[model samples]
Target: SSFPAVLTCKAAVAWGPGQPLVIEEVEVSPPQPMEIRVKVVSTSLCRSDLSAWETQAIFPRIFGHEASGVVESVGPGVTEFSEGDHVLTLFTGECKTCRHCTSGKSNMCQVLGLERKGVMHSDQKTRFSIKGKPIYHYCAVSSFSEYTVVHSGCAVKVSLAVPLEKICLLSCGVAAGLGAAWNVADISEGSTVVIYGLGTVGLSVAQGAKVRGASKIIGVDINPEKSEIAKTFGITHFVNPKECSESIQQVINRITDGGADYAFECIGDTGMITTALQSCCQGWGLTVTLGVPKVNPELTAHYGILLSGRTLRGSLFGGWKPKSDLPSLVDMYTKKEIQIDEYITHNISFEDINQAFTLMKEGKCLRCVIHL
Candidate 1:
């Protein structure tokens, strides 16, 4: 029997850092072993994509990770997913055989972990190319193109009943926030929670806290406009650091009467990590950092912060093993146990992808879904 031929499709390619993406016809190769080719129906713009586009030295790359689609073809030795199966692309995969996957204590899969070099984990080669020139992939799920090939472990099969466009948010931002609240922090009922930065991720954290029965969910952002919209996600208060006379931490401490039970730094600024720690109560206070810092990756918190029994930890993809955990999140969305549609502030065409980046850079939109 003959196999499918190489596909030439439209993909937004970034030739260099901070450059606008160029929509061009690129050749997508057939999936190798342990991989699957997907027809991306919907992709969302994420801050990490923007940061990578603006900063990462990897050029001639395709960048879109938070996405939903249908499996177009499966590679050799793959039986978990079939052609036409609806799926969500995962940046971090769960190779169930790894120690972390077996331990049930971590979502970081060693074999299919985060790919920083824009290539497949199994073969170290990209499936996207133009005229024999390769185009690097971002987070291994380059959904900016009409079609993308990803490792089978990096894609999670979802129900066909869910809308591909809306459920795409759960691929990253929404799931990350909810997981931080539920899995990492295990926020308790009636506890005070302070979240720094009210982006989609932060707001999702707020929503998770609310669902966990937290009494006060304070959202801190520079934009005062986010306050009204954030209230719908269960934020009880809003704090604008620029408007406060004292430090933001001081304001939070004063309002909560002794700092909050939990504080999350959602902004990708490492500087805010310390503020988040200080904003938490000394005893049993937990600070979870969810942001991918664009600069100054190193964090500096006073020794006393730890001495007082406060704990600081980091969360990646909300500590979710994509293949094993994302399906439950999809179920939660279907049951209305979570808010996926609320985060979609704009719907855009594939041609208008640059506009989505502008909306994110200007902080004008929570999430911009690109219809491919």
Candidate 2:
């Protein structure tokens, strides 16, 4: 029996930071042990992808992680997924055997955790190459190409009944927001929740809060235009920081009659983390930070913030173990318990990939789905 041959396919390669992606033919090697090769059907642009494309030094890389695809082939010693299985690519994978994975308290899988060096966890090597020159992968999924190879733990098998294009959002943004609200914060009914940022992730948080029966879900974003669209996702109020005369935190405190019960920092700005904390009530107030900061990773807060009984927490991928948790999210989408299609503001082709970045930077779209 012969293995699948190396595949030469179209991939959007970024040669330098802030440079437009070049669509070129690249060789995708067969999956190594504990890996799988996938035919990506749909991929979406994420803020983290944009941040990496603009700032991260890892260039000449393939940038994409939120995606849905079908398994083209499975590598040796892998039995969880088979060829032709529909799946969603996960940036942070769940190697169920790890301590954190089995603890039932964390979604961070130590073995297949976040890959920052643009290579596979099993080996510090890339599967994508152009004329024998390596092209780094973005978050291991690299769905910007027509085909990509990912560790089996980094991919979740989903039902064929779900639309590959829409369900792809669950691979990252939507799931993150939903998980932050439900798992991390455990938002209670009738509580006052304020979310800083109204991107897909923030809106998903709003939706989760609404589903949890929160009485007031306030969405804070600089863009006033997002207010109308955000209402559909359960946001009861919208605040534009630029328009407010007083501090945004003051405004939130006024509306909530002291402070909101929960505040979420979803804008990826470390500066906003403090504001989120300030907007929370004194006792039992929880602030959850979901953003990936571009710089100034260090966080500073007045000692009184903690002394006053307020808690600050961090959320990654909405506390979801991709392989073990994403399937239930897929089910929630199918049952209309969640909103995936509402977040897709634009659908573009692979050739127009750069346009998606523009829309994201300009804050013109919620999510741009790229058909591969």
Candidate 3:
């Protein structure tokens, strides 16, 4: 299939660190071998996207991870996807030939090295440019742009029965939370589950626990306003850290009769890592940290916590093999087995993306979807 030498499109570009994204015209090169060009239909702002923007670590890049779109063109050697196929963008790529992928224990395949470098895995070069200046790709799937070229491994075809706006949440937040409970934590039926942070990811955790038939689903957040909405996602009890006279962990300990069988920290705060671990039962309690910490903050906790039979684990995309597991999750959403509409608090055009960040910072929204 022949494609244009360069496709001109609108994109929210980060020209420099900490600078607000400017919606402007940019040039996207056609996909190379093993790559596919996608026209992003809808996307959502993820907390991690904000973290990356604030850190100013990778400037001059298009930043967006959670998205749904359609294939516009296929590069040479790309037979899995064709033009017009509905798909979701994956921040984490799955090259089934890699050792990690073949092991079935991890999704962090070898292509991650190139992705970390903000370049195409086949060739260490970016596909985006503004007036000839290079614009790095963020998370391998820069859905902030109207058009993006990604490796074939980063695009997963999904059924067109669902809307791109709704299914986009499954690209990251939905999959991460649900996978954390079912795949990583392996929450058993009738178990006590505690979730920290009541944002979209945290709420999704509560839903996962509910699906697992948890006896108790406890949600903890400093904001009292989140309590009511948390309950809608299967949270049995809500704990506001600010209202508690005692420490948050102490409050959870009292509520769970020792500690919760499974605990999750959905907000990426290094301090919360210790608190989440402490909120677990001394014997056989497991805690998973799903939040992405900022600027390599060192995590610390008392040794006694680990010695008491508690486990602290970290989840990347909820340990999902994107190409293999994410499709099933999309199917679950289409079947109404999962909730997506309740999480969307605001929907705005791609140009007003800066406001989405502000809404997230003020804790006023579950998720802000950007229509491209």
Candidate 4:
């Protein structure tokens, strides 16, 4: 089925940096070849979305990457999916022909990362516009709007059995966190795990560790209030950096008897990145960084940290190939192996979407599901 050549819909437009998204009536063009048009059913807010909103470099672009929706139309030559099929949007693409995708070593497919120029890869054009001015796509999904056109590779077909509102969390943050523990970190049973930051990602990490049979799960956060929620996800220990007279790393070392077997940094601050590495056990500890840093994306960790065999790794989309691994995550959620429904702290309407951001800024939400 094909949508009209043009359709008008409401979208939250990011006019400039450090500004509230203006909900505007925007025009969405029909999908070009190799693209598909989706009517967003539900989308969730992530810190990366917040980062893009605050950064001046990505202004004037639609900023949403995690969402689930139904297919409204399919462009020519699209065979993997059709109109009315339920789908989840993927910020990370998994074009099977790509070297990375074929090698099975990484999920950083070339096709997904190829659109850094802020336009559709097929025709190098913007599919959205307001008053004839083009709106650049954000992370290839731009799900902040009621409708979005994206590469067919960016849409993952999933079971209709799961509600779009509940499963949308798998579109990004949930998958990234679980994959970090399961795939990237390859967390082992009986391991000592420490996670910095008690947001959705960190809490998901705790769940992953529990699933893998980790004996000790420690959660560190500046906010002591997050301890209770973190505990719901299997966090057995909580460390408030403010309560310790010494450094948090030293505190963690004393608590873990030396250091944690694995440490994850989900706060997205470069300074925390260093501390996350140092909190790991010497000679065999592995640290994974799942946060998206807003500025100065460089780390200044001590050379001794690496010299002692503490490996530092960066996990994007939790190192899972979206098309292959994402569906299984949904299955996990369906089977009750992971928590998704519990993560939703708020259900918001499209007009009140900005309140989700406010809730995020105030550390009052785990994931805000925007009902489109």
* Number of the top lDDT candidate: 2
Error of 3 at 317 (Å): 0.5
How well is each residue in 230-256 modelled by candidate 4, as lDDT tens digits?
Answer: 888999999999998999999889888
How much is the lDDT of residue 32 in candidate 3?
92
Candidate 2: residue pairs that collide = none
lDDT score at residue 249, model 4, on the 0-100 scale: 90
Candidates 1 and 4, the one with greater TM-score: 1
Total residue pair clashes for candidate 2: 0
- Model 3 misplacement above 4 A: 112-114
TM-score of model 3 (CA atoms): 0.97
- Give lDDT tens digits, candidate 3, residues 282-367: 98999998888776578999999999999998878989998988888878887899999899999999889999989998899999
Please provide, for model 1 over 17-77, each residue's C-alpha lDDT reduced to its tens digit, 9 standing for 90 to 100. Answer: 9899999999999988889999999999999999999999998999999999999998888
Give the alpha-carbon lDDT of every model.
0.94, 0.94, 0.89, 0.89
- Per-candidate clashes come to 0, 0, 0, 0
Off by over 4 Å in 2: none
Error of 4 at 285 (Å): 0.5
Predictions ranked by lDDT, top down? 2, 1, 3, 4
TM-score of 2: 0.99
Q: Estimate each model's TM-score.
A: 0.99, 0.99, 0.97, 0.98
lDDT digits (tens) for residues 211-240 of candidate 2: 999999999999988999999999999999
